[model samples]
Target: MKKSTLALAVALGAIAQHAGAAGFIEDSKASVSSRTLYFNNDQRDALSANQRSARGVDQRETATGLKFNYQSGFTQGVVGFGIDAQALVGFHLDGGRGHHPNSNSFVPSDTDGSAVSSWSSASANVKARFSKTEAHLGGALAPNLPILIASDGRLLPQTFEGGTITSKEIDNVTFNAGQLEHATGRASSNSTGLAVNGGSKESNQFRFGGADWKVTKDLTLQYYYANLEDYYKQHFLGLVHVYPISEGQSFKTDLRYFDSSSDGKNGQAGYGFNNNGGYAKNANEVDNKTWSAMFTYALGGSAFMVGHQRVNDDGGFVWMNQGSVVNGNGGSEGAGGSSFYLFTDSMINSFVRAGENTTFGQYSYDFAALGVPGLKTSIAYLHGDNIKASNGSGDQSEWERDMRIDYTVQQGVLKGFGTTLRHGAYRGSGTGIHDQDQTRLIFNYTYSFL
Candidate 1:
């Protein structure tokens, strides 16, 4: 593609030379969201028993996201400049793949594979800020912290066209950095110049750094670093706390940490770049690090929890899950199924780490003291054990259980509407895929203009 757009125009001229235009954007805002999806799967060991005879079913999906923003405020002093725009659309109101639907990517495919419905993308960005910090170049659409994580799980939620930065000056501390070249996948519609799974060695590169600390007010701390250039190198740590043992009750603690290994040409020389092919070698590279702890307690409507995690080595502790949504909505930030890695992230499965030390616990509830104001609920369970490479190998184990319900609209007339329902089930014997059941439904809508 013309040398990947001349290497993304020389990497956006070095992120537009440190961007400086002044509080970029003075006004303008628009938003739209719509999604309805259902998908199912059952791999059956992926063929060769006469190519098996099963795959998956259930399908119905849709997507839409449109955003517009423009901010301008700094041109008079320090350094300010701004501009932002976004547009995305998709459609596939029904099922395809004859129903097995290629096993639920919802629907949208066509590189000679079939199943095509609709798609679209339009993006723009330009920014700069001083003091507290802000730097955004162009090609907008990043969902969160690390490198690339913007996944709404079909029907919309995946974007990239790089350059990002943030700072909170001291006080409580919060700093983030970014550098991305290209991406816009999720049954794509256009803007596909960089590839990872299809590999052609097209990448403008990405680098990241992060921090967030709040030593008081219940304590909080998090750290991060990421680089995905040739693909991989990550680190993250987190801590959350809140304790109070009476009236309204309080007791919560969440701790997480991760240190992944390998990068640049998949860690070059010593081999190690099998990503898929049923993996057996490449060692998947090692040097993993994981730690997890969960404790929650509440009384009004009940809340209780427990947690555990470990993965010292033998490969396991990967980050940037394949379904990364944009910067990482993956959560667990500690890099576990909620980690830049997880079980744990339902939707299909991500109990994270295929080899060793993975445990979990949960129970949550919030009915707004019985009045059901914006209701909230949770139920979870997970387990993983010394699961090293198996199938033509040994050492394996797995387990998962989940249930969730969410609601938001605390005021009249559907205020800020948001709703979610999730279900899960998983079982493993020797790990190479097994019985699993999952379902998800989420509704989101936002409006803001001033």
Candidate 2:
């Protein structure tokens, strides 16, 4: 199906024929969530063993996911109406066929390459409101805007299929606009058209607009613009502040910037760009400029962070990648993972190439200030340097380190049951990129039926 799920099933059959429409069943909501991952990757420079058996390179997997959501409130007012729905399922309890890897990146592969025992999908969204404005339409769009970031790392969450609007009429300002065309891949149940990382031509128009101005109560400001009709055009700016330093301590600041160019038929030939493999001034076009800054300090449950980023010797740093879009039954509409609203987006590296320069730091802790309630921990590190190198052969360097821990189950029958453990390590030298190590273990739960 997917014509945005047949126009959200004819707008949920006209909102289920207005089933007693008074505030839509008194403001409904429902939820279900579950996740379980256990993924591992090693590939530390897998040089041989036939290049680690043709690149499946030391992997491991496990999956479990379930998600359900429903929301329907609005429906009693002047112009209110609503519906939101989502459903997902993934289950592939283990890997092995030399650890999966027919490239749906994390799962969904079976044509003689294994993995893919279960998969499911569903989506809907139709909404409206007026007064402070709201609008949404079809296919579970998940946008955490600043020019787009919707990739929940794996096992589901990378959705989009069109239409959005938000307003918040004045008072502290917030506005957004959108028009996404297609994407659905956090492990494929197929939906694709949008491209960038090594574009194989797709781009069914993506447009955006943005705002966020909360000029006080600890300042904020942001701006955005985006376009992808034939391959790139982005702009963004941001700033945030919080400096209270007294009662529990605080000091935070963030800044970001981006500017990109090259749109129509970018660098031609199927709209090329492989800049992520570094250096690209005019070769596969799309110029870029990036910037970042971050600082944080909190004291109550301890937190500290630091950052710096820059990548602009000419290219690299672009988002929305359908990972070489291939579909029409030729397999893989796996939409190749993406996320960008960068703080160097890392876990196994994404110091966005072309003349890179990154530096990062982090430390976190919260054990309920040592009374240990729900626990937490963190560690991070990144170090990128100069990078460029693409035959002009010169600079390159990379580094990564990450760690995490979390726990939850705060009160009764497994209160909120959560657990996580993560790890990462990466290293590189000339940037053909291959040293790696990664791990994840997660479990989560949620249930609410209201």
Candidate 3:
């Protein structure tokens, strides 16, 4: 181990030791395991505004990660004492030097077409679980809601510092809360920096609450609220229902709504920051609202889907980027190259904004009936309209088409082998939107050590 790692272990052990280590220290049991992950991405036909072929290597990135998980059972039942832990280490592999340009993931195919030097960081979490729910306090990596969520679309993953609590005492009703502190950027191997969706750099502290209720066996409802330090406050409401028909046909519906406005800090200046260091002057504080609905019908081995969303005013949608601080949470949830808005992933905070409307459509097929058990494919397209920008202009529009494929070994020599691929194309004109194509590939494996 490196000197730094040894020192970290000693520090952690001393802290736990001094805390009386009594009621909370003695857990039921302890066990640890290891994990590994590999990732890659390649962009096609990329160029700068001058139409100058991006002046760099085409595109590609790769990384490897090793993770350690620790779990301690409750100390003595009733309200048992327990703790959960995770430690991660990642190394860059194929991301070339000079490839850090527009490096959404430390990989954009450097100017020299060679990979960058590898880097790593380590983090751990402390948790207490009882009944069906658990609460965690400590710092490792956080996948937060409200203003931001860590973008893990790369080799290893992102982490955050904070505390979170969850409960499922009542069926269909789940409650969650957390106070975040800081975030670790993806390309960076250490916890540092704060930024908002292609916006400016600033501190973000996030607080949120929500519930998911199963009104009936086929219908569900959800509501959520999130406040970001100095940035904005967001609200969300949603409904989902599924109906079955015939032997294997069903219709699924998902509807969502959101509203957002400036919070304490950003409201003061209206200036925003993005990953790279740059600032906008007199950035007008924005207000926005959105509603989106997606419906899917399944018949035989084919499934079709349609979804729509609308933004009401001049706000080009915003969310906490891994580099931002408001909610100070990070993780692999936002990984890869494309719009992160998909499902109503507001497991805590809402990701959509006002002044913009969006529509989503998808089609999928299962090959199991054709003798392929672990193979599945899906294609999706999303469009947005009625966007508002600081220039007091609307009509800023953008759309994306994406395709995904997944496969895993069911049984055989490589029983646990799994693979995934995502292909995407996006374009927009006016209001600071860029055009690009992206491809992401991931390979993961797990081993049992009981």
Question: Across residues 1-450, which tens digit of lDDT does each residue of candidate 3 receive?
Answer: 634345445645644643444555543333332223333222333454333224333444466656565555444445544555666655656534433343345422222333345555556665556887887665664554433455555555567766677889998788777766556655455564344454444554667778878889999888878776666678878788999987889988878776767776664543443211111223545355556678899987789998776655445455555442221222222222212344533111122433456667788998886898889999877766555544445566667778889898999887777788877777665635445566766776765443
Q: What are the per-residue Cα lDDT tens digits for candidate 1 across 367-413?
A: 88888877888888887766665232436677878787989897777
- Compute the lDDT of residue 92 as modeled in candidate 1: 58
Model 3 lDDT-worst window of ten: 273-282
Sum up the clashes in candidate 1.
38
> Candidate 2 lDDT (Cα, whole model)?
0.83
Each prediction's TM-score versus the true structure: 0.31, 0.34, 0.77
Residue 351, candidate 1: C-alpha displacement in angstroms? 3.4
lDDT of 2 by residue, 1-450 (tens): 757668767877877777477988788899989988999887767666566645566778889888898888877667877888898888888767776656665677766666668888887788878999998888877989878888888777778888889998999999999888887788888777888876778887798998999999899999999998888999999999999979989999999998989998889988888888878878888898899998999999998999899888888888776746544435454666877898889878789878788999999999898898899999999998888886645478988999999999999998999989999999898788889888989898989899
Best by lDDT: 2
Question: lDDT (CA) for every model shown?
Answer: 0.57, 0.83, 0.57
Q: Which model scores highest in TM-score?
A: 3
